[model samples]
Target: MEQQEVKTPEAVAMLDMLKAVPQQGKFMFGHHDDPVYGIGWDGDSARSDVKSVCGDYPAVMSFDLGRIEIYGDKNLDNVSTDRIRQEVVAQYERGGMVSFSWHADNPLTGKDSWDVSDSTVVKSILPGGANHDKFMGWLDKIADYLNSIQTADGTKVPVLFRPWHEHTGSWFWWGQNLCSTEDYKALWKMTYDRMQEKGATQLIYAYSPGTEPKDSTEYLERYPGDEIVDLIGVDAYQYDKDTFGQNLENALTIMTQVSKAHGKAMAVTETGYETIPDSVWWTGTLLPAIEKYPISYVLVWRNARERENHYYAPYPGQVSAADFVRFYEHPKTVFAEDMKQFEKKK
Candidate 1:
């Protein structure tokens, strides 16, 4: 074989080390100062919103149930699919992260038994049923859509597919009282295997188990392997930040330790001061640790305050937006301060 050149010893070493290791996860987006604010607009066409607002920033964007559904009434129309694919490839060229997730209200494949909460009025539903044939068919369709948008590196862009997330709670039909433990495991494993066979290896499956004591063991109980898990994370949302703080701290600490134990990196896959005013929490408590923790990313779960939601975008007070933006994006901020000093050391 011909000799290959090395740009830098560090670069060469990093590449060689990463070669055997499946690049598990990295900071998909930067710190708050380097914020990634992509919202769930009408559908895939909401690329306009991203392009208009934070286009310059390397943000992580995503599609919702409206854009990805296949059979249900929410299925992506032919026009949306064609348009979104074009937009997605453009995003790839622009070095933006493309992601899509689902929380189906009814994951039925025509079999009633497979539908766990058939009679109950669960707020969230899985997009798939546990029946082998119906599920495989659904997975094939889903994987095909994802494969259509490969990265510039020729691999499908790694997706932050967070289905069946927050299962410790009962709001979603897949949670506590909905399905048996075995069925849940079977559902998870089958989904993983089905997606892999279809060549959508670019997916970064995030098992975002709820931040309750019971779900802690259940989270790792079915972790397929490093091959399947891209990032280990938690979806914790409640009023008491003081109470949630200890839980959040312990969760991240334990997750980081456990992930490191398995040689995987950690992330606060979904988090934010949802109802709490951004002022008290964003700067007072959250910012102090912005540079302190080993967290890879902190995605502000933006449930835009449109439909009587207090968790609206632009954050709380008018001043809060400025403070929020400055804290995350401003110079001399923790994130920026840390980076500036760290780079000088390098």
Candidate 2:
């Protein structure tokens, strides 16, 4: 493929960046508007909707890294890594500012049972530390992969690398189920240090703890540090419309509170609300909620459709990008102080 020279910008030092403001902004959380909105209509296909919804976003979500596996004896090599990396970068260049999220029970390196959320993998990595080496190694590999990319000005892609997101909840292997606060903190630090060692400075690491904390103070405790993160965000979903409404509100309040507290931009990294025959993401839920907030970006789960995938939006009868454009340009909705509005609202 083609390679470009990359020049790193003097981005506000992440910590100092957090200090610029009181750590709060408008429209911080997100939701899917018109399940068919930006995705248009195509049924439940995942890849097809990528192009359409890509236009609606200021940043694209890298679900592949978050959900897909590529390390260990999984036949990972330059060709293997390069293959997916090519596709990812192509998607990145196509979509522009891309943010990624992912989780794997397997430490950051191996391709073993740890990749699954099952008990075996979960039990192996829990608490005061059990196979810490493997976990650290896995992180090294992940960082190597991130450092491999270059931007148009010859810089690595500045990714919002969010791993083990929503740790406040108990669903994934790394959730509260497997580790204590101290262990979790170590895991976060190890990953950060390894990535830095690899020269993967393009990262704007995000620590998205869960929103189900006993209160706001508890939520703040989940933050690893402003030192390792550039933004603050959250993820929540409701099985039905009713529950979704309540949870969406809670999510917004928490995301806004977290971002403002940390002086960071915010978005909804993941959300899915199913409603009977149509799991309408746009009109049914996201639209009503976001109307009252000024979110930075709303990244639907990158997947298209899968029984196991709660992170996708349906393509058929999909909402058009026009809806997002109107929202983006809404006179009262401010995106960010320095956002680049490249595409006009459709």
Candidate 3:
């Protein structure tokens, strides 16, 4: 299938790099970290640990913008917006790929991302609804932060801006049952349109569903379109040995097929075994499931210092630390040290 042409030069360059991932025989690894504020591994410390353990930092870094539109201070797991922005710019300067996911609060309920009290929240925020203007106001804050991210030389840092992720899951207010497919599509379109209008052109949209769909039809049911979405992915996690590897494998297989059909890059936007109870979960479970597909990247959850059992990646003393190190050393896994070979979008 012919790849969809990207409008922005930066996006085009990024797409090219992503498309080349499989050819390089490596997939970039990412981790979500509130590292800057010391909630996760300390600022620069996560990377330092990755380097010490695996001889390099992760090739990609992820952050959440869940609370920036609401509190402006407190956030998902108490991560500060100030620290997030700083960390984003720092990662960009270091030539690392950065991705952001929005666990946006439900506009109508004034509750968290998990709130499902208002099933029509997306409808309310669409065109001529009651909360449309208020939602746009929130988007304004998001666009402002996105536009303000830049490198030391004033280059706009490109980000894989993934919003409304895991829409197939029922845990979030924007989940499948909470909003109609049309409303979900409208939500994504409005986000892209608003951000572009606000000069946040460094953004590349990604569409991620929760689990593996039965086929492409199910996968693309709520997809905005190929033109608006640059990446296709899923958010699948492993909780036990029963469905761990099979679930991930099935999700990636679906993602690969769907991405090929639309000519978009595929990614494991979110996947990890929390606490990594299995000593060999890294190479044995995660790697085998992903290596079969041509994915651009795979991002583990995070290592929160506050929550002793909430982390996905291994620390120095964790049981899976040795296996994770082996996973990092694998020929198919790309870490921060390997990113120098890839072209960074300007």
Candidate 4:
């Protein structure tokens, strides 16, 4: 596929690196909030559950901008934006990539992202809506945060920006049932245009829907457009062990086809067996499911310190730790250290 044009040089390089991963027969290992906190600690600089199990950090580290829309100092998960900025730059310095997801509050109800009481929320935030200006203000905060992630030399760090994720599910206010397809597309374009106008150019936009889409036709139901999306991904988590692999493989097949048609990179944007009850889940389950796909990366959810059995990746002494080491050592898996090669070439 030909290279896709982007708004900034850094984003172009980042997209190139992402596109090269599958061609090189490797996919990056990623973990949400990897270095920011882990299964037993928070606010510890340079600590990660993945690194604790293996010896390297994830190549792609995911962060959430849940409360940034409200101008909150800390996100919904209680992570401070200041700390997130520091860790993002630190990861970039270490030759790793970062991605952000927003769980912005519902504009009409002033409730959390999960609030689906009002189905008109999407319409309320578009141009000329009562909450249009308020939502624009929220976008300003997000744009500022995106632009603030820079190296000491003032070069902006390129990042994967995924918003309105999992819209196929009705759990969030922007879900399929909550908004019209045209409204959803409009919402995405509005946000994209606003970010560009605000100069948050160091971004590669990713469109990630939940696993409800069984085929390309279903998947593209709410797709914004090819011109605006750099990556196409799916967020599917393991619920039943018996059906997870087949379901994930099916989703990946659809995504691979769609991405090929669109000339875009693809990924397993969010996935994992929570708490990792199976000892060899990494190699036995997750790896086998994704190994055949031309995915750029697969990111497990975060390891919440405050919640019991809420972690995804293994920490030290966990049942899956040894198998995770084997996963790390596998030639198909790329970590932060492995990413240095791409950085040098870029």
TM-score of each: 0.68, 0.69, 0.93, 0.97
Top lDDT prediction, candidate number? 4
**If both were scored by lDDT, which would come out higher, candidate 3 or candidate 4?**
4
**For residues 241-272, what per-residue lDDT tens digits would candidate 2 score against the true structure?**
67666776777787677776766676656665
For all candidates in order, the CA lDDT equals 0.49, 0.52, 0.81, 0.92
C-alpha RMSD (angstroms) for model 1? 7.9
Clashing residue pairs in candidate 1, if any? 32-328, 33-328, 33-329, 104-125, 305-312
Pick the TM-score winner. Answer: 4
> What is the Cα-based TM-score of model 3?
0.93
After best superposition, candidate 1 residue 68: deviation in angstroms?
2.8
Better of 2 and 4 by TM-score: 4
**Model 1 stretches astray by more than 4 angstroms:** 1-58, 65-67, 71-79, 82-87, 109-131, 151-155, 214-219, 289-291, 303-306, 310-312, 315-319, 330-346
Better of 1 and 4 by TM-score: 4
Candidate 4: misplaced stretches above 4 Å?
1-6, 344-346
